[model samples]
Target: MIEHATHQKIALITGANKGIGRAAAEQLAALGMTVLIGARDPRRGEEAAAALRAAGGNAHQVTLDVTDQATARAAAQQIDERFGHLDVLINNAGITGSGQVSPEDAHDQVPSSVNLDMVRAVFETNVFGVIAVTNAMLPLLRRSPAPRIVNVSSAAGSLTIASDPDGPLTGLPTSAAYTPSKTALNALTVQYANELRKNGFLVNAADPGYVDTEINNHSGYLTVAQGAAALVRLATLGADGPTGGFFSEDGPVPW
Candidate 1:
């Protein structure tokens, strides 16, 4: 059982073993928050925690698979027993069904030929997983004086951008599975924010920009730190910060 100073803010980041999630954890820890690295693999999670600790950050590992209900509940229970409260929750676990962003690879995701099973798989992790993890952690988050929930979303999730002829997403040959899943996540973010607004909970969705992460097969131009900036900003929002909005590093993203 790892323990942290009671006064330190505790943050849990899912899919934190690598990619943008890992970058967010490191940055949050640098701000003196006790970051809980949540990953499906215990070994990888422990290693990530160890890396953060070696860098003089207060970090711990929590075995969490966002798509698995049992794991989500168990992780919440562990956090509840250990910290008694949670200050920040960053739902960063997500997947791009095709595993790559190349046009050739994404060709299979076109509306006509796309597999419904693949779409379900994408939603399982990107949409339902966020709901599962958020519901499980709400109890702990509610105990915080200023609770913040950051849903790691994507620019592709914006219906306005997808429809705009001049938008970056307009001409991209993306899949229905990944893109729609993010759209659903963005919608979920708004609903959750609306429901929790009066409770002093700030729930917002963040578009991490195009980062060269495993999800994109390193096709994105932005670095992990660049991608994680908006998420970290949303997670550490002040009491007066805006909620129920979609934001990118540059600023507000069209719904």
Candidate 2:
């Protein structure tokens, strides 16, 4: 039987019911960490955890909603009561805020005419949600010997890439919601890393590199497993791993 002991490192991944988040949880579980599959939907969360358990991984479900402070706090409380500490926190929950906009149409996200509500909604999840969940779990994470936090960001959020005339996004319509939310997330990652570095926390942002998932209607070239590699790598980093930085599967990503 797989052991669910306090001696084992515990990882809590937000929105871990599916997509990159679920993929990260699976990878972490394979690495011998007690994985907590955090999902807003309890049913989905339990299904994911059961699947992992059936695969010989130690996994549990945590009813969590990044946007809801009550659920976030409740998840933290539940973790504290069960395991007493959390070794890793992967803030993988995010949204493109592209409701009804087809993947082909970038016009809805264009700066000038973009809906303000969409922008706010995107920030609420992609940016503010991270803060809510992280803060809620900070106490439990503090008790760990080594703590790690990985914020799933995107290449579109990279200012350097977006600003380059010859970059991949040169001719793409200017994004006002999804892209900006990721940028803000990256910035938040840095600030958190700075604040917690002295306390032995490794906080970094990861660019999953256009994985085929619900966010883009499966238009991405990469698979979920391929995209989750960066997050898993960062989450399992050694003591000397770089903090307050952005990375992809290949290497460092410029800010």
Candidate 3:
């Protein structure tokens, strides 16, 4: 295996070619971590890595498609060959199940009339994909001195918030796809944290509040940097940081 600096932290972020994932990579890279930009498209991934390098950050590209286990395994093998171990994992790939439609026009996602196929697709990427990637990389992560896993979740996944009568999402249309997938992801995050805690792993879910990205067709009010803050914070948390919990920029998010 190729050797890297033993003291330097290495991070892999899926869907890091743009949006919140890329922003989180930028922050991590700025903090002196070698960031790996994981994208389904090789060209896009290379472009993003090159951009980060140009900006004076250590970056690399890894072809990753969370929905495909073959690609996940290949990514793991590649990382093992190059870095020998992985210090951080940011499972950030996700979908809104609305296609190219705007949030306000996502009537098709209404629980009563939502497409089962769309829901499955969303879960394939957001929930199951995380499991695939995490399991594949667990061996490499195990080699790190302080392994950290951060699952990029959303506030919509908070059942307590959605159920509140006067909550911020009170007026939003009922969702049956994207939102539920994130809820499942949140649960999965906690399970992983519980299972890996004895190994000194800091695993947590981050609720990146609404950000202007392709997921919502730029309808969100927050910037990408703002959306990525919670993720970066959790990935670099101290050993005393909370595990098996959901948090946002403000503080803990009710699950």
Error of 3 at 77 (Å): 0.3
RMSD of each: 2.5, 2.6, 2.0
Q: Which candidate do you rate higher for lDDT, 2 or 3? A: 3
Residue-pair clash count for candidate 1: 0
Q: What value of lDDT does candidate 1 attain over all alpha carbons?
A: 0.91
- Identify the leading candidate in terms of lDDT: 3
- Where does candidate 3 stray beyond 4 Å? 100-106
lDDT of 3 by residue, 171-222 (tens): 8888899889989999999999999999999999999998999888799999
RMSD of 3: 2.0
User: If scored against the real structure, what TM-score would every candidate get?
Assistant: 0.94, 0.95, 0.96
Clash totals, every prediction: 0, 0, 0
lDDT of 1 by residue, 117-201 (tens): 7778789999999999999999999989899999999989999989888878766896688889999999999999999999999
Per-residue lDDT, model 1, residue 221, is 96
The residue pairs found clashing in candidate 2 are: none
Please list the residue runs of candidate 1 whose C-alpha ends up more than 4 Å from where it truly belongs after superposition: 1-6, 99-107
Considering every candidate listed, which one attains the maximal TM-score? 3
